[model samples]
Target: MLLCFMGSIDRFRETVPLAELEREGRVQTSVDGRALALFHHEGEIRVVDNRCPHMGFPLSEGSVEDGVLTCHWHHARFELSCGDTFDPWADDVQTFPVEIRDGSVYVDPHPEPDEPPAEHWMRRLEDGLEQNLRLVVAKSAIGLADAGVSSDAVVERGVRFGSRYRESGWGPGLTILAAMRNVLPDLADDDRKRALYQGLVHVAGDCADAPPRFDQEPFDTEDVSFERLKAWFRENIKVRDADGAERVLRTAIANGADDAHLAEMLVAAATDHRYLNTGHTLDFVNKACEVLDHVGWDHGDAVLPSLIEGMATATRAEERSSWRQPVDLAAMVSETFADLDSLVESGAGTEWSPPASFTETLLSDDPEIVVAALEDAIREGASVEALAREVAFAAGTRVAQFATVNEFSDWNTVHHTFTYANAVHQLARRTGARELYRGVFDAAINVYLDRFLNTPPAPLPRPASSTETDLSVHLDELLDSFDVEGEVDEAGRRAAHYLDCGGDVSLLRERLAESLLREDAGFHTYQALEAGFTQAELRDSPEEVRTLLVAVARYLSAHFPTRREREQTFTIAARLHRGEKIHEEGQ
Candidate 1:
């Protein structure tokens, strides 16, 4: 029996056990420092190279089923006995001779022959890439043709160029062809004709390592056929063939064309279809509106109301069974409203208001209809306040049921926070509601403080020079809202404990300054310092305030500053009493 060992078999035996191969059905072992796959198949022990021929996946770790080993990566299979390729699409792995002698399995220590040339492998890769591209283009073209485009012009154009370009290897040619097909109905006839010619002539010249630009820009388009096609489409077909042309184009577009390009095609089809068939203009408009709605056109006020009125009239004219009537009407109205909202957001058409007629319809006696209308409005970015008021009024008049404030809040959070915040701020400023603003400021401060106190100290906001004064003012307002006495008591306890624990006074002073800087100071300079001091030992407070107050006192003593300034005088006195003295007046 010959032992086929490639690398250090000792290292392989150390990582995996021999018994694991028998019990587990397969075991990956490295022998002679090379990976080896060991498994029992058909009542006989077998071993083979661990690496796959394709992509170098470890075969030993793969599954063994019915004498075949399957590579876990990419599902390439190999025959364990001969190391022959089992998967027709993939290459084969190397086989090694193994035998069991004296109750122990032995492997031959010899490497397999060298792999094929890089050029040979590259040719295969290029072929595979081209084949995949052809499949994709063919499939897409067939789908487009099936969508009622009677003229096979688009597909023929694709095939002609696709075949000619495939010789150079189909990568660049397939991409251009796919792009053309996606935008065929949308592009002007001249552009489509040019694109077809470009695909054919694009990759000419340079058999050996050609520049990519040759593949990108086709030879200067002076070909008479290309020029003739362009001229015919421009002068003759565009004007005369508008109706017949648009029908084919729209069919191509509806049959899985490109999204951004198909929008223009649908629009053109709608316009031409309406003009050509006046009796069916309303039907064409409805279909076009459906497509526009799908594309999320926010039909600002002008287009949406008209579309909704049209849909309403259609619904009334159509009398169908219970099942179809409600579903169709609901779908039409919903789609129209959605398109209207999209149009509004897109800034399309003129700014539109909800028409009185439609608003009355929304407030109709039928609860189901009203509910459906409200849902559509909500889906389209209608304000929460507007929706809620409508619901409330509707419910009061037995038109519809109302929703709760929590529901409105939830809805607003998802859709209307930007509008709501701006509106609230505007109201506060216009009404001069300082108290209301103060309440909001306090709430914001509490939220920030709660987050900071619970979470780790985050990196502080980079201090801004101009904004520092504004921050100080806000800090003061926040401080005024706090219970100073209660905060001071807590600070006193903390200070007493720190002193008892032998903490340095300088460290305490630094901590107090940091706390002051970190505190949410809401639009009031003095209150910011007050809030900081209320939470710190008075003796540990910063000297800037003391210096400022001392200057204020000297000015007051020099000239009696007003009663408004008396508060500043008293504050300075208290600081001085607390052993925080200023060195110089106004210095």
Candidate 2:
């Protein structure tokens, strides 16, 4: 036994006798509430925090060989002396000063202030983003967020890093940030934190492996007018010349072009090719604007350039008329465009709500009637808000009516129509830009054109009378029987039953959303399901709500087929390892 004495403050305190630790290779002791592992390696004493930084596993149980300490759980290795981890996922652990005092081991518990907590964590965030280390990224995000760092700072940093590191420019990660940005406002407090973390993760991962980007020099003109810049931007985007477009945008920004002008230019380019890229290019551009709002306009230099790249690289769905069969969509859409101005002017001061028949008019296979009815409603004094809501619902119906037989990629077809319409609806409500209404008109035209693509057409349940079934129980049954054939019809009927019984549509919607979230559905499912709910929320009519819910039920039931159940192989292996009968007692 060793008699140890406490030293002055800031001095190392004897933790354990070296002779006691000689029997084992290491010893775990606490000094001032800090746990540390003291190791006897090659006659030299080394000390480090006992907790593995990876998952808080006690490092005292870890193996030390060849100057490396290895965690038994995940095989994370660290240099015993420096405490640097070889695994990026497991962050470097803190090492303490070791002192030998009278055959006893002493450890200094106080950590040296190598850097400020905020700065150190900020650097870790960069490393996590660069390496695509999920746990490290999450920890850094949470730590930074808890330290009162704004997500704006994190986003600005990510935008700078991503733009500089990826030579090819914005990729899916940028798009992902753009995509997730819209959901932040709708998320709860905790979920908002998660959303921020996810957005940063994508931006970081996108730039991780790529080389630095060399931005094109701004056109050497000091006085490029907003109009001329706008003209050039539209032209370059139209021709799919990303370099030309980026220069025009950058030059415009440098010459004092306001974000409003930049927005108009992007919108002009987006609408130039009606429903471009099934509306995703436009949606992405809109999301980019949202990113600007979160991160501040200073990042526009890098962020907007990526948007230009998206515009240049997008595959415009409007260019292809292959899906316009059974109807002359080109002619129908053109006629509707001619009447848009007169319709808006006439409907400017009118007080009207969309008739119950608007859904039927929308669902009708005739593009001409649909367009004409929409214009008539607007001319008859239907508010832009009402019109927006109507068209938005029709777009959701297109998604809901889409059949799964259209192949995996075909989901985009309806998704484009729905998202495009939803974006226009949202923009109209926000800015009341008449041009955005035209987007709605274009979406409607496309929706009408896509009516036939629903091949087996969505099965809308036509229950004779709404039954008195508990909506919650019905939803549960719908989920339970999702794998069985004809379940889509049952789902529709259940939806109808709930609507008839005067159920809380929002509750039912929440259930549906929860089911999708739990099932690990794809992106398109989320887009479609969410669009339908948004449309439903905008409407004032119960009948319209019923129709929307039925469509949602049908869409989800059709797309989300039964996942085959399987036993866990690890469980089977464990059973076999226990000495249980191998191979079912026979065979």
Candidate 3:
């Protein structure tokens, strides 16, 4: 043993005597709570952090041979002097400066400083995205969150990366990113990071299989007016010319069309064909606007262009016989369009609420009746958003009441309709464009198309059904129900009871996120949960919230307990973050 003192980067403190270290070939010691490993390889004494960067295994127990130190636990090898890991999964270990003076060894706890925390994490994020390493991305998310980096900054990186990388344009990954961003305020601190992590991880994965995006340049002249450009853009979308639409869109942005105008243009084209792409086109357009809100309209060049491909190529509902036949819901929606401007003008200056049975008529079996009721509401002073909101509320009941007897994929039928209606509701609130109101009509018709999903409507979780007063108990019951397959009705009952007992909405939201994130949830699941929170917030009644909550619960429960490979990967990331000894045996 030797008395030791440590100094800054320029100096080193004495550790064990060189003679004893030479005899043993290696030694471990603690200084300032850090486990330091001293290795006598060749003629020099080298020092490094004893803990493995991957899982906090004791590297002192690892083997050093020929200037390479390998952790036996996972066989991660690092350079003896610089501590660079040969394995990317195992991050570089911290190596300290070593000196020898007067037959004793000295070590400096600090090494040359690297980049700033935020910059380092951002760089790590880039690497993670590029490599599609889920664990690496998870660590980057955790690091960024710990460094107090706002999700806005993190999301900007993801959007730019995804846009530049995925040739297929905006996919579920970017939607998840934006949707998760929308719900962050409702999540707990840890769940917030998880949400960001899930978004980032999905982005990396979504881009992995696709080739890089090659954006086309703006048109040669910036002489196009907004109206002319909008016309050309919609025309291009109608013809399914993605390249032409991209060029026109790029022209619009270059000619100074801001996000609001850009969104209106998208909504107009999206509604032109009535529920395009089974509602994904509209839903995706809505998400694009959302992501742009936080990442900035300045990024419209990168973020907005990605949506052109989805828009121009989306499948129009008119192509489906189900929408065209048995009711011609498509034409019904189109007929209402002619009167939209006048109806919207008539409703001006009047705050509107749904007629008591308006949504019921929208949900009833008759498509004509549904269309007539919507038009009637507009005449009776129902605003575009008020109409869209009730339509979305009725759409929620489809999910809350969606029958288990239907084939499992039918959950998505009602799920798609609700999300589409909610997207319209979201857009309606953003701007009062008369053309955008077409989506309200399109979405209502979609809900009408999905009426059979409620054939044997699942019992609504009656609010007062549960007498349990403890919110935590209700939350626990909700989670436990998810552990079983098809506990859909039970899950809804639990959430309904939680609200009945006056559970905090935010806390309930956090619990929902926890449940969803705990499994291998899908893209639509994220959308439903986030959209449910937003839609529920607009309504003043507990009953409305219950309906939304039950809808989300059943939707989530129906898809619960996926292999959870994603959660397993996330758990590994969390353990590494906590410096837990993951490689230890006999726990």
Best by TM-score: 3
TM-score of 1: 0.22
Model 2: per-residue lDDT, tens digit, 1-587? Answer: 33345653546777898898777889998888777898989878889888777766678889999999999878899999899999877888789888777888877788675677678778888887788765666667666766778777776776677667777666556655544454444454444445455556667767766777778778898876787888888899889998998898889878876666667777777776667766777766665666687788777887777677667878765566643555556556666677778877887666887787887788777767887887888788876556777787776766656665666566577667777777677655655555565676777776776676676776555654546655667667767755565466677777777677677776677666544433334445555565667667777777667778777777676666634111122223223223233333352
Tell me the spans in candidate 3 whose CA falls farther than 4 Å from its real position.
1-11, 345-351, 465-468
Against the hidden reference, what TM-scores do the models get?
0.22, 0.78, 0.95
Give the Å error, residue 540, model 2: 5.2
Write down the lDDT of every candidate, Cα atoms only: 0.34, 0.69, 0.85
Count clashing pairs, candidate 1.
30
- Worst 10-residue lDDT window for candidate 2 reads 564-573
In the predicted model 3, the residue pairs found to clash are: none
lDDT of 1 by residue, 78-151 (tens): 87777776553455566666655445566654644554333333333233233432222222222223333322
lDDT of 3 by residue, 1-587 (tens): 33434542344667889999999999999876678999999988889899887767888999998999999888999998898889877778889988788999988776565667788778889988998988888888988988889999999999999988999899899999999999888888888888899999889999996899898888989777888988988899999999898988898889888777888888888888878888998888889899889989999989888988888878888889987787676777766787778887787777777767776787888777888888878877887777888989999988999999999999888999999989999888876566767888887887877878788677797656445566798889899988999999999988888888878877878888898887878999998998898899898988888899889988999999688887777787778777666766764
| Residue-pair clashes per candidate | 30, 0, 0
